[model samples]
Target: MTEAINDWMAGFEARIADLQRKSADLQQNIAASGATATSPDGGVRVTVGPTGALQDLQLAPSTTRYPPAELAGIIMRVAAEAQREAAHRVAQAFAPVAEGTDAMRMLQEFLPPPPEHVSDAPVDGLPGVDDIDEPPQPSTPPPSPPPPAAPPRPPRRPSTQDDDDFEQPW
Candidate 1:
């Protein structure tokens, strides 16, 4: 009986190992395919690697007017948003490999909770931590453009010949 039990445990351990290896591979794939997030209003943009490291930032000209404190706050918020997006994307990209298993749960261990909701819904059904969804599509179609207009030219006026050419210093 003891020998039989050992054999069963060994098989279980091997199965777990196989699952773990597959999970690691899925993670590597996700890391290779990265994600980025940017402020729609063009205020800020940030990119994060799959490992959640800060990769890059681009700031709009308008942000230059902000004081250091305010700028820092905006940067922090933007970075957080970017990171959240990256995490969500990673989870999503790996979903195919992660579904119906514990892999997705393991992936969540790497991500910090969102500021408002602490649930792990993003990767709940995937094999890895889910990547954030891409921002929603714009609702309305672009407005029909008006016909192009000619550029305006400055108004011209005739000069009077009797106008004084010189003025007194006093």
Candidate 2:
């Protein structure tokens, strides 16, 4: 019985040491992680840390041409992209630690779903203009009838009282 208990204690100590080593590795990987992204126009760049906090932003000289609102929008877009990249890196770092465990499911619940990828190919359900090859010739429309002529006005009557009544002061 004493030998059996000693063996169990040794196994338990080994498992604890292994877990501590893995935890240390995970922390190191997470600390080293970061991500960066740039705007589509390349006027704005953003960097994010492992926890997805903004670490830095850079703007090109050409970014001055953009209006304030547009610049703000570009900055936000680039920052979001950087944050997504950081989240991806953090998830990758956590992968080995969480694999095949309930922690993996819990970690997935905290992470955002992967972004949907857009394809250059036209949507399957909709018809594309390129599919038609040639533009359809429009059918000739019927000529519209001319507008009806205006009705003729009656001829003016000749005045009998004339210019003499115009001189009276009333």
Candidate 3:
């Protein structure tokens, strides 16, 4: 019975370790993945990290031709594009962990797809795939047989001898 419990525990721990490794891999991929987008005329550029936070921005001297409001609009649009692209990369990064699971479906439903044109910037390319992957679930071991009941001792026998080892009533 003890052996059985040990075997079950070992297998459960191995599965847990595998799950942790998968989570780490997914996090590393997400950190490494990001996207950048630029306006068509190259007047505006925006870079976003895996989480869609703006990491960098660049404006060309030619952008001065546009009114301040117009340039702001252009910048906003390009930033949004970069954010969308970053979301796509993040989704890809989650693939190893979430693919074909309900969590992946939720991610696909929430994370926006990358822009149609990769030529917008010099950023890395993203596949047309949608959705991420699954989340981890802990497994429990089957119940083990209860420990065997302790053996019973024989009943005490009455002493028949009047030796020093025996106690006698007065």
Candidate 4:
């Protein structure tokens, strides 16, 4: 067991060294290339240092129309999006050295493992089903066929109350 642990530790140390070297490369690339990320709406621009620090920000002219609080919100949202993109780029750049290492395998542990086996037993008779005695009830018998509806009323004829004032011009 101790030998197994030592082996794992050795692999872990190698992975760390590789990550450090990759980080150095990433820093150099960032310094040379000066990565810039922009918001989807093009309303904000963010510049980052090689070590992933915010270097600068540029705001669009249309942002002035918004109220002070709203404008601050917009800027914050845009900056957050740009920062995420920058971090993604950094991760992607480090992928070459980090892909197959123990560190990557450790990350994979966070995901739920696949089921070892599937049972053929029915769900209705499961052990906990008895605890929940209140099964769903059906709707009220289709409203009792709507009480056979009321009989239709007869149409009324027009009244002769206004005919007395009319003149026949035939």
Can you tell me which runs of candidate 4 are displaced by over 4 Å?
1-27, 30-35, 105-170
For residues 16-130, what per-residue lDDT tens digits would candidate 3 score against the true structure? 9999999999889899888899887778999988888999999999777666766787788789888888887888989888899998889889986554543322112221112
lDDT of each: 0.67, 0.73, 0.77, 0.58
Please list all clashing residue pairs in model 2, or write none if there are none: none
Q: What are the candidates' C-alpha RMSDs?
A: 18.4, 10.9, 32.9, 20.7
lDDT tens digits by residue: candidate 2, 33-86: 788897655668898899888899999997776667656766776677777778
Model 1 lDDT, full chain set: 0.67
Per-residue accuracy of model 4 over 2-107 as CA lDDT, tens digit each:
9999999999999899788888986665455435766445666777654446789998885555567655655565455555555555555555656888875664
TM-score order, best first, reads 2, 3, 1, 4
When sorted by lDDT, best at the front, the candidate numbers are: 3, 2, 1, 4
lDDT, model 2:
0.73
Residue 137 error, candidate 2, Å: 24
Clashes of each: 14, 0, 5, 0
How does each model score on TM-score? 0.46, 0.62, 0.59, 0.41
- lDDT winner among the candidates? 3
TM match of model 1 to true structure: 0.46
lDDT-superior candidate, 2 or 3: 3
